[model samples]
Target chain A: MNNVYLYNDSFNELISLIFYLLKNNIKPTNIKDVSYNPNLFEECIFLGIKSKEQDINNIALQFGYYAFRCIYYVYLSNNESKELIIYYFILNAIKYRKKITYMRNLKCVHETLRIAEYVSHETHKMKGFTRFKEINNNILYAEIEPVNNILELVSKHFEKRLKNEYWIIKDVQRRLFSVYDKKNFYIIPEENLKLEDFRISKEEKEIKEMWQLFYKTIGIKERKNDRCRMNFMPKRYWKYLIEMEDEL
Target chain B: MELKEKLKILADSAKYDASCSSSGSNRTSKNGLGNTAIAGICHSFASDGRCISLLKILMTNCCIFDCKYCLNRKSNNIKRAIFTPEEICEITINFYRRNYIEGLFLSSGIIKSPDYTMELMIKTITLLRNKYHFGGYIHAKAIPGASEILLRKLGSLVDRLSANIELPTENGLKLLAPNKDSNKVDKIMSYVKEKQNRKFVPAGQSTQMIIGATKESDLDIMSKSSSMYDNYKLKRVFYSAYIPINKDNLLPTLEKPPLVRENRLYQADWLLRYYNFKVNDLLNENNPNFNILVDPKTDWALRNIELFPKEINKCSYYDLLKIPGIGVKSAQRILKARRNFTITFDELKKLGVVLKRAKYFITCNGKYFMSSSYFKKEFIEANIVLEDKSIENTKIEQLGLFNE
Candidate 1:
């Protein structure tokens, strides 16, 4: 009989499921996200892992801090099998120590690195591409639609740069917003925000127009290479770029 | 003039300069308006394909001297605009807050005097850093003949500073930019280098060199770059392909930018910094110019065939980096992965080594990827991937690879 583990999209739930399966000595046929509702009644074990640093460090210890970060980041990716990959990677790392990360040829390690890279790339791009417009001359508001759930990753970056300002970064695709006040930042996950909340200022519109003109003037006529530009700043990202709006 | 009109004019005036780097500074403050990353951030790409990393512009396009190659020269007849210190500071803070720029690249013409231009720039940065509480990366150009005191004060405020070399040779300097002295530019660069405190100009100093304009050979440029790196410890030496903007007897009559030569110089520059290569390794007295067909590293590997077919698994980290397709990341991966197990050709590809180019130079456990004799240069040259052939027109590709 195959033992199936079900989890919510919480890091704690995934950790608890791993421990539960190990303790029961049950071979998991599949460990699936409960949000997806992959299974109805296949010997599912619903787990509630109260996340402790010691428990996480127990699983993440062998490969050091970097390996733990990769596990955290990759777990947040849109990859369906990300949870399974993390489990196998951690299991291997527990036996092998930090050398498991260098073993890229292994399927689990390869997928783990790929997912981490994918998420980090999106986070880095959002750091630059996320354009904020002053709404009502009081608060700054911006929107993005990243492939990965990277709002949590990019929030700390903005928190450092715009510490004194009140701002909101809306992940439009996921319908989540990372809201930061003058003091600190927190996330409001779900369809709680509305367009009416932000009223664009006339000065913000003027500055954006002026910026677009500067972008237009900054390029050289003789060295016009659209293919080269598209490679670095891909077409998917064009929707987020303010300068790209007028060109379309 | 309106803000839109001034932005257009000033940005147009500044586009000729190729340095848009905002890298090599790790700045943070408790409640500052901005912080800088170690690798820097590129805000956007202009239609011309250059990175819009910083709000690259001149404080004023109006100048006292007429440098023949310059668009903003005194005699160019272009519409000139001078931005006030207040305007510069306001825009820097606003744009930075909007995520439009990582910082600002402030270069100016010698309006009235060197000290005068430098002082205004220093004032702009001072207000932005202290008053606005902005902590973004600031790269400023040091006015060549500015007072040392002004340069020191300017250095303390910005993350990086530069003094453009303008031309490679002394004669080229005299012929085109007569008002400027190359030695004086060096004086400012040396001054930037001499800063004992790491906090001041923490990203270090860099300079720009205009190539293919005058009668200077490739050897002249490389030799000059070699010495500049040794003497001044420049963070970077930018090679701008001489774009023909004016009809001058002194300037070369080229319809297009010499991007190929510029690209080669950059590749050679990489070898100097990362790959443990000297300018002499890239070019000697007789072989002054580089091979137009292949990249500089590949070209060197083809000529020095005896060093070929190194065992990738057994080779040192430095030797692995010497291979064209094996970059720093791939080399490090190979080192780490090999410690666990013997790396295979398929595994090398998985590790991000470009096997197409690397196959000629590397081996795996006494097995070569392809059967190609190293005795013949043309055989190796023809067999190796012509990476540059596909990317001849787009200097923008270089921008993506080498941000700084």
Candidate 2:
């Protein structure tokens, strides 16, 4: 009999599900979140099991830190088979410990490493591509629609880099905002945000025009290649980019 | 004058420079508004497909020297503008807070004297760092004839410093930029090398040279880059294809810049830096220029075909890197994965190997991935050329515009 595990789309809940499977030695046929649609053949197991902070620490201890990180990053990737890949990845990791990491020839191990790298690469690109606009009372607001669940990672990076500013990073697809108050940040839902309260500053209008002009003139006219521009900054990212607004 | 007008004049002139990297600095914010990442970040891409990591601009376009190749030469009839130190600080801070750029790249034309120009740059940067408490990456251009003390002071304030060796040879410099001396550029490089205590230019020094404006071959250019790396310990050497801005009798009249050659030189530059290949290994007196068709690595592999059919499962990491398509990362992956289980040809593709190029050069488990007929030089070259048709089309189409 095949068992399919279903849970919410949260990293903590995913960790709890992994712990439940490892503790009970249950081999899950497929692992998915609540958003996943299931077939009639498999037995659906709704996992309401939640692991505490200590249990997560135990999971980290059981599987090596590097392997645990790989699993977490794989879970964050947009790959449809990432859950099953992680399921097999953890089982092999627990069986072989450090040796499994070097076994990249295995299908599960290779997929796990590849998917994790893709997510991290996207996060790094987001760090550079996220553009902030000044709103009312000198607060900064930026919106991004990334493929992965990378808001926490990107927010952590800006927490160190842009530590002195009050900013909000809104993940448009997830409908979540990582709001930072110059000291600490919290992930809040869209319902809590007052859309009408946000107003663009007059100075910001002039600055935006200047930036758009700068972007237009900075490129060499002799070397203009739309293919190359789209290669680095994909067309998908153009929706939020102020400079690319004209091009789009 | 409005700030937007001045930005247009200065940034248009500064667009010719090719260096926009923000990597190599690890400066963090301490009660400041910004910080620098060691790995660097590119904020945007220009329409030409170049990375824009910094707000590259000039302090002023009013140059004293009449460089024949420069758009901002003294003899050129163009509108000029200058930014005050306070104006620069305001723009930098505002743009930085908005995350429009990683940092600033400030360069200038010689005004009155080199020392006077260097002093103005120093004042602006010091104010930005001290008064504004800006902790972001700053790349300053070192005037070749400036005093050592001013260069030293500017070096400590900025993260990266560069002095462009505009043309390759001394004759090219004399013909194009008569007032600039090559020896002064070397002196600044040596001075920066001596003051490498991490407090001075923590990201190290870099230099750029214009290609196709001079008669220097690929061999001559690569030889110079190799020496600069060894002597000055420079971080990077940028190659900018000479764009025909001011048409002089001494300059070659071309319809478009030599982008293919510039791209080939960068490929060869990576080989020198990462692939452990020397100048002589890729080019010599007989073959002084890169083959504009295939990449430098593929060309080198074709020339040195006796070392081919390297066993992917048994070859060392460096040998795997020598393959035409296997890069450093994929080679490391192959090395790690092969230790656990034997890597097949299909598995090699999964490990990120570009098998279209590597199939002719690599073997899997003592079996040839390609047919024995592919061992012929002509056959492999034809197939490789076919694989790179898109790159060839872009180059030819750009050059074909001039021919018509």
Output the number of the TM-score-best candidate.
2
Candidate 2 chain A — worst ten consecutive residues by lDDT sum? Answer: A51-60
Please give, for residues A45-84, the per-residue lDDT of candidate 2 as tens digits: 9968875787567547876787778888888788887888
Clashes of 1: 0
List candidate 2 stretches off by more than 4 Å.
Answer: A35-37, A52-55, A58-63, B390-404
Model 2 docking category: medium
Which 10 successive residues of model 1 chain B have the least lDDT summed? B384-393
For candidate 1, chain B by itself scores a TM value of: 0.94
Q: Tell me chain A's TM-score in each of the predictions.
A: 0.91, 0.91
lDDT of 1 by residue, B1-404 (tens): 98778778888898998998888998896667888988878889888777888999899999998999999888887898999888988888889889999999999888899999999999999988888888899999999888999989999999999989989988889899999998899898888778835688999888889988987878889888889999999989999999999888877899789988998999888888888888877888899898888889998888787887789889898898888777888889899999888888888777766787777777888787666445366777876545545555466676667555
DockQ of 1: 0.66
Tell me each candidate's i-RMS in Å. 2.3, 2.0
- Candidate 1 Cα misplacement greater than 4 A, ranges: A1-4, A22-25, A39-52, A193-197, B371-376, B385-404
RMSD of every prediction: 3.5, 2.7
**Residue A106 deviation, candidate 1, in Å?**
0.9
